[model samples]
Target: MRMHKVNTAVTLGAVALLTAAMGTASAAPPAGRTPHPQPAHPVIVDCVWHPQVRPADFMIACGDGNSSLSSLRWSHWDQGSATASGVNVVNDCKPYCAAGRFHSYPVTVRLDHPQPWKKNPRVQHYTQMSLVYTDGRPDGFDRVVTYSLWN
Candidate 1:
């Protein structure tokens, strides 16, 4: 009876050892495939000093509220840059400030040149924005216009 008990104990110990060994072997990553570290995503600093990611609407004229972007459809948003297609809304101000006609134009937007935010040191924000007019642009504007965003 004692011999039988000793054999049973040995068998259980060997089984447990093999089970642990197998588990450890399978836990390692596959050969020739190293995990890649993901890049940090940058944000857009708004006029009100708010950090936003892929915002649908953004204001361009923070001082007088004369220009802005709307209905933005972002195609790419990554660590280095972002791209979108939207409409540029501007006040013509044909005669005066209060009696100005608003105009809308199709535009493609690009955001890049990431830098550390002034308000938040740890977070990065896109500092430059480029707008390419596809259909039409506002007066005194070129085919492509670049603006420095507020940080």
Candidate 2:
């Protein structure tokens, strides 16, 4: 009789727990409160393969760290495209790379051609990066230059 009572008690406890869990699972949000959806914002994949949004500084040349963008002021960032104005700093390998001088130029940066990132298929990353120099630019560099960002 004691064993039968224990079994019945265990079964009843399990059923009660399951019923409470099901009720909680199907319950709606609290009164006067609605769930907020998450934003599907686009990003820029950095050299180390990380998604970044409105980064202040970004390296252009991943190989030798010769070219980079700094002091970025992003005016717009969305799924279609992004625009920013920053300073492009380039290392002038004058005599040698080890002993190089860095130069900064006023530039407007535009990012487009977004696609799904390889590492994270659900995330979108900018594939194209274009820079238009507003003032003096680096030697041997054009007024407008475009590069392919790593995904």
Off by over 4 Å in 1: 1-40
For all candidates in order, the CA lDDT equals 0.91, 0.91
RMSD of each: 11.2, 7.2
lDDT of 1 by residue, 1-151 (tens): 9999999999999999999999988786788765542226888988888788899999999988889999999999987899999999999988985799899999999999998888876778999999999998899999999999987
Candidate 2 residue spans exceeding 4 A from truth? 1-39
What is residue 138's positional error in candidate 1, in angstroms?
A: 1.0
The worst-scoring run of ten residues by lDDT in candidate 2 lies at 32-41
TM-score of 2: 0.74
Reference-based lDDT, residue 38, model 2: 27
Scored by Cα lDDT, where does model 1 land? 0.91
